[model samples]
Target chain A: MSTLLECKGLFKSYSGRPALKNVNLAIESGHIVGLLGPNGSGKTTLIKLINGLLTPTQGELYINQNPVGVESKKIVSYLPDHTYLDMNLKVRDIISYFMDFYEDFDEKKAYDMLSKLRINPGDKLNTMSKGTKEKVQLILVMSRRAKLYVLDEPIAGVDPAARDYILDIILSNYEEDATILISTHLIADIENILDQVIFLKHGEISLISSVDDIRSGQGKSVDALFREVFRC
Target chain B: MLGKYMKHEFKETGKLMIPLNLVILVFTLLGMVMLGSRLLSTPAMALIGIASLTLYILTLFAIFIVVYVYFTVRFYKTMYQSQGYLTHTLPLSTGSIVNTKVFVSLFWVTVTVVFTTLSIIALVYTAMGQEWGKMAVDSDISFLKELLFSFLLPCFSLTILGCLEQLLMIYASLAIGQLFRQYRVLASIGTFFVFYIALQILGTLTMFFTQFFSMDRLFHISENISGDSFIPFYRQLFSVSTIEVIVFCIVFYILCYWLTDKKLNLE
Candidate 1:
């Protein structure tokens, strides 16, 4: 698979403090990669950098050989940790809004997903519960046939049952060649689906290996290694 | 992409702006009906009429204020707040994003100001009845007035330029504010006041310096301080006020765009 994303010596600093330090990484197409890290390990910061939502304080980052920019953003679908949509807008309006900007956005697919979720298209986002809103956001992101999907903390703020539903939807969605980089602290729940896991610790990558390799060589599950590595 | 951005921008803002305009239209209609009819001749109706008149004036002022506040807040929310996560991720250039905002803001500001001015005129016409015609016939200024040069044209240009500058200024402040690690909203508000006060002080100093230079003052042409001084005075107006406003607009616009495009630090 081709390299879908590349970050070279990436550094992000807030004031004088570093969030991501000298991180060199590449993500290939057609895999679900788990970016496993503890809190403040810079997963969201890295995701934001990839999405062109934040500029790098130093070094280079690219999507499909192009720098983070309008061109790069075209093929990257980002689901922020927060509820990032306008709550005042109707779900239908937001779907149309997605349709308006993204050429790859599937309007029919969006509506279909909304209907299946028993979500009313005419309902304003603010009226929905947070779980419903997150589902709507997931539907919107997955409806796009983007080259790379970067979901930041997709299951962080949800109940266990909803987490399974979200995970199921994420697994079923997307094309064969598309890659997904899911950032989460929850390991055991997602390690089953992950082809590769990158363990980040304190603004640095502690490990980057295939889950199978870790299981065979390390004599432990990816979750077990994550616990041992990040056992502060 | 610019078109799509503008379309969404319009859709987002139109929800509030459209109803606000409708209220103005409905109020103007009501005002015309009440003022043009004998209803206000009754004591209670006259008292109610007075209240409605006050309300209409307040509505006119509120239109401008609401448009400014709503557009500014919308810009902040969408471009800098959590919603910014979605916005900055769009497959669109920063140029498109910022330009779309600039045009939508300009469109709303111009529309509200125009509507307010026209509504005020309509109310005045209704209030005056035949007095408008009488005044038009009696006034020397009406005939002698170069409508294009002195009154209508300049007012229209000034209104547009003024609104553009204000909108861009607020946008620039919001853009600058997002650079801070915390208290971004408070920072944005502070930035706006800093820009405002600096501009005010600079303007006063410019006036002082211009007077020091014995340049033809801004008031000279409008005040009719001298005879047949029209062309020279307007030349100075265009050179001075028009250029000054345009410079501020361009500066604020560029500051807003460049900072948003290059220096964005969305938390």
Candidate 2:
């Protein structure tokens, strides 16, 4: 598999405080990777940098060997941690909106997912429960045939059952050659599904290893190892 | 892509604008009916007339406030707030995004101004009947033609240019303000006032310098001057302001696009 993402000495700072500092990493295709970190560990900041929401203070980051830009945005499907959909729009309107901007958007698949979730297409976003809105956003992001999926804390807000459903949807919907980078702190819940795990601490990547390697070498689960490494 | 962006922008803004426009139309018609007719003999009719007129005026005021506030708020909310997660991720150039917004905003503002002007004209036409038309036709033909061609048309164009300049100034201010980590909204408001004051000072300096250099003499004609001289004089005056407005628009647009593309700091 070829490399899908590269960050060389990636550094981002806000008000002279470092959010991500001297981070170098590469992601290859066809694997689900967990970007595990505690709160304020620069997980979301890294995700936003990938999505072009914030410019880097120094260094370089690239997607598919191309620098972060409109072209990179075209091939990356991103789901932010917060509710980003316009509240005044209905579910159907937002679907159309996604379809209009993303040429790779699958309208039929999106509608099918909405139906499975028992979400009416005509329901206004403001009226939907927070979980339902998150589901809608996930469905939209997953419906795109993108080369990279950058999901920031995708399963954080949903219930356990809904989390399973979301994981299932994510696991089943992406292309075979695409890479998934899921940023979350719920390591135990998603450890089984992640082929590789990256542990971030204090604006730096402390560990990057395959799940099987961590289990075999450390003789413990990834979550247990994470607790050992990042324990206060 | 710009077309798609503009289409969505229009749809979103139209939801608020269409209803407001309808209200304006309905109230304008009601006012015409109340004022144009002679149904004010009784105290009740007189009170109704006054109430309807007041409502009509208030609705007109609401149209202006609502449209301006809606566009400004929509720009801030969609581009800087949570919705920015969706907006900035789109596979389009920042220029296209900013241009689509500026165009749609200008479109709606123009519609509101035109609608308000037409509503007032209609009201006056209803009240004056044929007298207004006869008076317009009986005026000095050469003078009327000169006024329309030299003054009114230039003023109309300048009004539009000025509107675009102001809208872009707001956009640039918001873009600069979002770079702040805290007090982003307050920063944006401060940026706007700073830009406003700077522009005011620049305008005053320009006017002062022009007067100092006796540029106004170009437009000051003797009372005995012929009608043909009016066109050249007005054209010169209009060109200076037009060029200035265009420059401001370009500068503001570049600032907005650069800040959005290079220095985006979305929350």
Candidate 3:
């Protein structure tokens, strides 16, 4: 029950307009948590704040009880909403770079993941299709034995087949002791895999419940409750 | 990390630089050819020497432009666009990246200037049939040093300033400009204009203060007011001193690094 991430009264804005407002969240290790929200509901912002990509304007965020900074960044594997990989690098070169910089990067696991996806290490990123590129990025991030994995819209811009493959890769590669916070609007697709779900609406938590609790206590699936709660 | 950073810097820089170096090589070769053709038919050896020297000066100018533009563009794109986000975000300290880039820039500038000078000297010696050394001795070896310093010193100082200015202006420009996605380019230009005006105002203020107070400290102009009128204006270059230049460079680097490290939106 050790906390992997903690956010208290987190606030953020762009150009004086609020993106996130006094949002509080806490996640513990060894759980697959689905972060369900409508578009522009600050799911990505919260993930970004946790990853130290965007500094919070107000309040505090901690990763593994440490403040978010270079140290936190080192232990957090962040898969950004967009591709962060340089398009000019070969897959092998990119792997070497991560292996050189990150202490926790698992080269063997990365290679195995790539082989499973049939992605050649010699292939240039620019030459790969967008879906394949996302797969490569996912492989690289998940190859790390990070304390927490922050995946922002990993399945957004891909084919259904590719999405399933990505999910499978994520499930297989994630360390058993680590936590994962996956932010997406596609709740039905991810509900089966997620042990816990956090529903966000207009930058506030609408619901946070375990899948078993949702089914047993309310006699309803997490997806049905999500649709009911977030109905327009 | 710095070694890897410089390796990529050199690799990417060489892509544009090799062509510029070749252009300087061809200019030197052509100047040599022209001098050789003239020397074959003329008895006026001094005139030939003079003509060769003029061509050498022109080649030096060409060298300066090629290297300056190549480094400017190469450094900007690589440092800002490709590797900058990674560099700024990494656990490494800020001073390391700045120092590495400054050294790399100075390295390329020195290489370009020295190689171009050597190429010109080689061409001159080849065209003049071993009399090049005699010409140098006759013209006083001091004259060659003077010629080099005269041609390169101002350009060198300006090149350093140009690099620092671009580094500062571009970072601030990008930071402010990136706030607006729709008119980012226009905003960048506006920022540059504002920064340029601010720099000019600073320069004017410095001039006014120096003229009012540093007349004695800068010029020792009490010798002869009328005779040393030009000295006050001309010696500002010498009076500002190298320490001032170094301090300004440090300040500019710190400002650039701070803005880049804090405000970067790696979109």
Which lDDT tens digits does candidate 3 get at residues A1-232?
8998899999987767788888888899999999999998989878867755566778999988988766786778888777666688899988987886677899999999899889999999999988888889899889999889889888887878887888898898898889999999887788889999888888878788889999999999888998888888
Q: State the lDDT of candidate 1 residue by residue for B39-114, as single tens digits.
A: 8998988899889888888878887788889989989988998988888988888988999988988997788777
lDDT, candidate 2, A107-190, per-residue tens: 999999999999999999999989999999999999999999999999996789998999999998997889999999999889
The residue-by-residue lDDT of candidate 2 on B1-267, one tens digit each, is 888888888887888888887876776787678667767658999897778667777888877887777878889998989998899999988888898999999998888777787788888788776898898888888788888878888888888888899899889888988999999889989999999999899888866665566555544656536767656766766787788889989999999999999989874
TM-score, every prediction = 0.93, 0.94, 0.80
Could you say which candidate leads in DockQ?
A: 2
Residue B202, model 3: Cα distance from true site in angstroms: 2.7
Model 2 TM-score is 0.94
For candidate 1 chain B, which ten residues in a row score worst on lDDT? B230-239
Q: What is the Å distance of residue B112 in model 2 from its true position?
A: 0.8
Over the stretch A43-133, how does candidate 1's per-residue lDDT look in tens digits? 9888888887788999999899999888888898888898998898899989988998889998988888888889999999999998899
> For model 1, what is the error of residue B71's alpha carbon versus the real structure, in angstroms, after optimal superposition?
0.8
Clashing pairs in 3: none
| Reference-based lDDT, residue B72, model 3 | 48
Model 1's CAPRI class?
A: high
